[model samples]
Target: MGFIDQLKTEYRVGGIVQRLIFWNIGLFIIPMILFSILKLGSVDIGIFDWTNPFSDDFFSLSSNPVDLLWKPWSVLGYAFLHSGFMHVLFNMLTLYFAGRLFLTFFTQKQLFGLYVLSAIFAGLVYILGYNLLPLLVGQTAKMTGASAAIMAILVATAVYAPYYEVRLMLIGTVKLWHIALVFIVLDLIYAPLDNSGGHIAHLAGDLFGFIYIKLLQSGSDLTKGVSGTIDFFANLFKSRKSAPFKKVHRNTTPPVRNSAVKPKDVTQKQIDEILDKISQSGYDSLTKEEKDFLFKVSK
Candidate 1:
């Protein structure tokens, strides 16, 4: 299949992780391309430069709390943006790995909710740290990237399955917590060196991830609120599709059923059976024909 068609198919079936990745990548790329074209055409757009997401006042989170009053969406919007190529690349790669690990132990809704909530939490922490910390006094900074959300997923997964092992390229297999510790330590070490605000945000994400899992274990699902809010808004904007018009035909003769006749089309009962099998044994357990039938029905 062509790239766009393949993307569409994958998006339809790939669940929330893929959707999140698509969103981050789209948010980063589309604006860059659009603004580059506009710049080439000699069109001057003031202040909000798409080339540098960090410089964009409208979306990227600022160190000042007062900025939040004006750009409240930045709490979550910043997580979907990146300042540069490497910024987005490593973030997305980590997200793919961490998000998959998280999904193995949690629902898609929980993963998504944790991501959004953690990003907001981290943004708030970033603002608070900049204002309250004596060392950060009189310093102004802006932050952007999915690193905060990605860190939350990574740390949350590790906290839940500390012993889970995964193989690395240069390095051998290591425990999930080992990986989480390494990243957390790096953030701590760099918090005072460079990109301090970003590092602070990462640490906040790590903290939220740990707290999120603890609360979840105690039977308090923090993700439910985020999921419910998203669902309500989704339902609010969702358009109701009308059924297509069909012509009615009357036949004088009655149809006859033959024992020798073979059915060429799939039935609702067959679809339900396949769906039940999927729910019981997972999508990978489906046979080739079953997979094809399901895909066709989805289309």
Candidate 2:
């Protein structure tokens, strides 16, 4: 298959995190192509011009009051926007590894929740630092990149699975928590210096991720509120079906004798037991009964 076709196939079968990385890389490439064509025709596509924070079209929540209403969406959109190929590649690589680690413990909804929340917090930190800190340093700046979001995911995954270990190309296997600590420390130390606003943003995202996992462990879900809001709007466009879809109550049916063999019912307790076993001893250690129970429960 051709390169684009291969990418499409990967996107179709890959997890949500991989698909997100593909989409961002794809969007970044499109602008480069457009800019190249414009240059050949003696015209400027003004890609950088549009991206500059000081530019008229630059997206801002505070400076542009109207954008504040739309700023929440920017958290998502900014994740996909990149200035260069290297930038896209670096961010996607970090996302691929960090996301895989994150998914090992978190549900898809929780992963997405952390990602979106991280991006928003990152943007907020950038804005606050640039606007407020400039009073002391007499300088304002703009920031961009997926680093903040990546940091958030890295920290969240570490928080969730501190014992998880991964081998680096040249380095030996290391615990995930150690990696998270390095990033946090780096951001904290550099927040006052070069790319100060970006570092501040990264710290903010990291803080959100850390707090989110803590809340999750206590049985509170931050994502539920965001998901509920999304569902509220989604239901608006859904068409109302006919009343023929009315359901019959199970209580209305009389108990009938079964001729065929019935499968064993797997209760929630059984499922939890299987999960605990898998967590402690790994999936390969499961017996046939446990495997069957897990398969049924998953369905």
Best by lDDT: 1
TM-score of each: 0.83, 0.70
Q: Candidate 2, which ten residues in sequence have the lowest lDDT sum?
A: 52-61
State model 1's lDDT.
Answer: 0.86
Candidate 2 Cα misplacement greater than 4 A, ranges? 1-4, 44-76, 134-138, 229-299
| Number of colliding residue pairs in model 1 | 0
Each candidate: RMSD: 5.1, 9.0
In model 1, the Cα lDDT at residue 128 comes to: 93
The lDDT of each candidate is 0.86, 0.69
Q: After TM-score superposition, what is the CA distance of residue 236 in candidate 1 from its true location, in Å?
A: 3.7
Q: At residue 122, give the lDDT of candidate 1.
A: 96
